[model samples]
Target chain A: MSDTSFDSQTREASFGDYFALLKPRVMSLVVFTALVGLLVAPGSVHPVEGFAAILFIALGGGASGALNMWWDADIDRIMKRTQSRPIPSGKVGAEEALALGLALSGISVIMLALASNIVAGALLAFTIFFYVVIYSMWLKRSTPQNIVIGGAAGAFPPMIGWAVATGGVSIESIMMFALVFFWTPPHFWALALFMKSDYSEAKVPMLTVTHGRKVTRQQIFGYTLLLAGLAIGTGFTSLGGPVYWAAAVVLNLLFIKGAWTILRRDEEVAEADNYAAEKSFFKLSLLYLFLHFGAILADAVLMRMGVTFGGLL
Target chain B: MTFRPDHELHKRRKGRNIGVGLVLVGFVALVFLLTVVKVERGGSLQGFDHTQRIDMVPQGSNK
Candidate 1:
């Protein structure tokens, strides 16, 4: 008697596949930025509560990712880049993704509220709703500026972290939010530049698909300029230090140079040389944001010690 | 007829069950730790005890 008999053998989904629905990579970014937000704030939280705060924030980010996947399952099926995702690959059902997302979203918000503060919890709820409903359901298909508008969802982590500590927003927290908000366009448009035909094939209205490579390149340069200005200017704020200021200077210079190189390239050159410049720029963009936030974190840590600017640690 | 313990479904289900069991255990531990931390910090000690503790004051409030 095979009591474990099931109707469909092809539906043998694994736990890892269910986990895949959460988008771990994106969750890492959320965790990192949220941590920077918390660590740099004016006050401090107990380490255990801080750890719990980060965990629940990450859970919230993952929940939104699951919701995004559920909403974008159709496009995910068509996109080569996302073809092997849990839903697209048939490892997890679309409805299961939705249910898990909803469950996790509720759990995360409540837990964060209990573990941290209501403000952080409310912000997490808004972030999930914004990403799933505003970004995924509406803006993604409706406009080329989806990344710009939707980028706000990704930028709220640090602010939420700050709220967790200070229990309110401040100018310093806004600066942190703006840093990621501006950085998102340049970083993602660079990907859209080299990732030719993926967005087009999937019918997603990325800047490159809606406008053209030339305009997308221009937009990339434009956003890089904005990002550079803000990144460097932030050094004067409470979130900055000698370390962050130095990092900002070097990173922005390199980023601007890379964007300029991309701006000067044409289809002939890009095609002939295999988009090497765009690819490198894409890679550099990852490092650029990482190091900027890393510097912020480093500065915060250094300041927590008796360290001083231009003086011995 | 006999149920095969070594069946493929059993193997997969074993892994799934273990994963789910670990998550539940972790959640319980998390709640326990949270309760401990909250009680230690006087964040959740507002009920049943009428003692006025200073740590119970909201961090943002001027008590």
Candidate 2:
């Protein structure tokens, strides 16, 4: 581990540095998916309770980010893409980041339990532990399948939200979890295809680094196929409707096509074009999750309206 | 103790720390208040109906 001590010459850390430690972009995705889960669950949550649930969920996600940054500071310093992160950049000390992460983890878990229920609180706590301890500390440098298994940590927020509303899990929450879980491999592999050197330099066992580009590309296509099935299958569930179904069909077709286009490209072709196809696929993956969750929320709202109006008719 | 020359920097850091501490305390108080409200209202804050029985009395107490 790198020295956790603070540098005396280091300037005072700004609020932005602390915020960067939380990884706001990832936190936004957590907030959005958790909101959709709460909205679509069978039971109703008061608006205030719902807000509190999402807030605590987002805090939990942020805590995980801080802890991940703290643990990964050494490798992060070596990677060009992550070299500017707060701890690596010397804007914040590693010890400070660890302290912030632990504090937020406690506060978020306890507040979530009070605001929602024990199940959601427990799930949030588990999610943090999994991401920080299992994924970041254990799997990240040890195995090529790190992202494949570690993806579960990212996939738990929506389920946590569902649990908050209903005090339990169900098919709807599981499908939501599965969607993110399966989408992670292809989504990350595409980026790995482009940023191969970063993983090699950091000695992280990403599939692209350990197994070669050909194997990684094939895996991306394979996972995308499974993701397509899960995405469409989710549309048939009680949580889905016509809007969600149509959205799922269109989005999955586009995603699969993107994966296929990536699979067809040789490394030479990818390098020549600066991994254009892979980059585009990576961009599409971001849209894929958001649209899927958005459709679920829309479907839930539509179904509620249908039941409310059907009573009058 | 080491001699410190940057007195202004030290003062600024102290001010910032105090500010952050106050904000944290305020946030904790807010969350506590919200939790209390939710529990007292029986898992909700809307539609106050306070006529529910507490069952605090004995079954046949004349005193």
lDDT of each: 0.90, 0.88
In candidate 2, which residue pairs clash? none
- State the TM-score of candidate 1 restricted to chain B: 0.63
Model 1, C-alpha of A71: deviation from truth (Å): 0.8
| DockQ comparisons of all candidates to the true complex | 0.44, 0.17
lDDT of 1 by residue, A1-313 (tens): 4444653563677778888899999999999999999998988798888998999999999999999999999999999889999999988889999999999999999999999999999999999999999999999998999999999999999999999999989988899899999999988988877776677777889888789889999999999999998997798888889889889999999999999999999889998999999999999999998999999999899988969886763
Task: Tell how far residue A197 is off in model 1, in angstroms.
Answer: 3.4
Which pairs clash in model 1?
A: none
Per-residue lDDT for A1-313 in model 2, tens only?
A: 2223323434677666787899999999899999999999997887778888898999999999999999999999999999999998888999999999999999999989988899999999999999999999999999999999999999999999999999999998999999999999999999888875687788999898789899999999999999999998897788677778888999999999999998898999999999999999999999999989998898788778875324535
Q: How accurate is candidate 2 locally (lDDT)?
A: 0.88
Q: Please provide, for model 2 over B1-63, each residue's C-alpha lDDT reduced to its tens digit, 9 standing for 90 to 100.
A: 897465544555776687678868977776776766676665222336644343533456442
Regions of model 2 farther than 4 Å from truth: A1-10, A307-313, B1-22, B43-63
| Candidate with maximal TM-score | 1
